[model samples]
Target: MSVRRTVTVSITPEQDALLCAFLASGRYRSISEVMRSALRLLERDEAATLTAMRRPVAHDEASRG
Candidate 1:
C-alpha cells in the first residue's frame, strides 16, 4: 500500500479544455490518472535527456583511451 497526497494546481483554460477532452474520450478515469501518466512520460524524457547529454563525453573518453 502507498500513501497519497492531494495538491492543488492552477492550469490555463486551454489546459483545462485538453483535460476535459481526455475525460470525454474515456481514456482516463480522472484528472489524477492523466496527471500520473504525464508525470511518467516526463520522468522518462528527463532520463533519456540525461543519457543523451552523457553520450558525447563517454565517446570522447573512449576515443582517448
Candidate 2:
C-alpha cells in the first residue's frame, strides 16, 4: 500500500564508484536497492534521534511531580 516514484539524482564520481563497489560485491542488486537500504538506515537513525530528543530527563520528571 505504498506509492513509489523514480527520482533522478546527480552524484559525484566518488559516490558513483562507491555504489558500483557495492554492486560488485554482489550484495545489492541495483542502485535502487542500495539507495533504499541506505535510506532505511537513515530513517531508523533519525527516528532514534527524535525519540531520544523527546524523552524527558529524570530530573525534569522529578521537578514536574
Candidate 3:
C-alpha cells in the first residue's frame, strides 16, 4: 500500500467556490482529488522546466572548438 499523510491548507472564499463548482460539475469526486490533480500538473511543469535548464546551449557548444 502507499503511504499517505494529512495536510492543512487555507484558501480564499473565491478559491473555495471554485472547488465547489468543480465538485458540482461531477468531474471530481472530492476536493482532495482536484487538489491532487492540480499538484500533479504543477509537478510535471516544474520537471519540464528543470530538464530544459539542464540542456546545453547549441550555440555555446559550437564556439568551444
Best by lDDT: 2
lDDT by residue (1-65, candidate 2, tens digit) is 68989999999999999999999999999999999999999999999999999998899889999
Which candidate model has the greater TM-score, 2 or 3? 2
Per-candidate TM-score against the hidden true structure = 0.84, 0.77, 0.77
Off by over 4 Å in 1: 57-65
Tens digits of per-residue lDDT, candidate 1, 1-65, equal 68999999999999999999999999999999999999999999999999988777876789999
Clashes per candidate (backbone, < 3 Å): 0, 0, 0
Whichever of 1 and 3 has more lDDT, that candidate is 3
In model 1, which range of ten residues has the least summed lDDT? 52-61
lDDT of each: 0.95, 0.97, 0.96
RMSD of each: 2.8, 3.0, 2.3
Clashing pairs in 2: none
Model 2: lDDT equals: 0.97
Q: List the residue pairs that clash in candidate 3.
A: none
Tens digit of per-residue lDDT, candidate 3, span 7-54: 999999999999999999999999999999999999999999999899
Off by over 4 Å in 3: 59-65
Scored against the true structure, residue 45 in model 1 reaches a CA lDDT of: 100
What are the clashing pairs of model 1? none
